[model samples]
Target: MPMAANEIEALIREGIPDAEVEITDLAGDGDHYAARVTAESFRGMPRVKQHQAVYAALGERMGGVLHALQLTTAAPAKE
Candidate 1:
């Protein structure tokens, strides 16, 4: 079973709390998704770690249910 965009976003929010997440179905397939996550907590973290946090949020679903995720993550812009 493929993951829904809202499900993915909810999971990320559950894990990251303050994260702002946007999910898009790239190929109009439930299996392929692109996520843009921005959070203040991501500040000072390395990009790899940022991605790791999102992957962790998805847990086992990443490899099993969700096939492909094109993820982009960042800390909020300085204001």
Candidate 2:
């Protein structure tokens, strides 16, 4: 019951509609992933807080369906 990349992306999008997400399969097993997400919602949030936001989007799946996620989150870059 590994989590798919699309599933992860969709969940993030559900939480932050304007999110720009790049998901990579770190292990090629669908269980380990790395995600780089940029969103306005992350503006002013601390790094840990930003990561928590993304984790919260996954709910209980964090330990079960989704094994591991390495995340890099930030507000969208200034033009």
Candidate 3:
């Protein structure tokens, strides 16, 4: 089964409480998605590590039920 956008966002939020998450259905198919996650907590982390954090939130579903995802992460911009 494909994961829902809200479910992805919820999972990211669960892992990073301060995350600003935006999910897009890339292929108009539930199996493909692109997620943009911004959080202050991501500051100072390498891109790979930042992505790892989001993947960790999804547990074992990354290549299973979640299928494909193009993920982007960033620290929130300072005001």
lDDT of each: 0.95, 0.91, 0.94
**Candidate 1 residue 10 C-alpha distance from true site, Å:** 0.4
lDDT score at residue 35, model 3, on the 0-100 scale:
97
Candidate order by decreasing TM-score: 1, 3, 2
| Candidate 1 lDDT, 1-79, residue by residue in tens | 7788999999999999999999999988799999999999999999999999999999999978999999999999998
Lowest summed lDDT across 10 adjacent residues in model 1 is found at 1-10
Which prediction has the highest lDDT against the true structure?
1
lDDT per residue as tens, model 2, 1-79: 7889999999988977888999999999999999999999889999999899888887888888999988899998898
Model 1 deviation from native, Cα RMSD in Å: 0.6
lDDT of 3 by residue, 1-79 (tens): 7889999999999998999999999998899999999999999999999999999998898999989999999998898
Of the pair 1 and 3, which is ahead by lDDT? 1
Pick by TM-score: 1 or 2, better one: 1
Name model 1 segments beyond 4 Å from true. none
Pairs clashing in candidate 2?
Answer: none
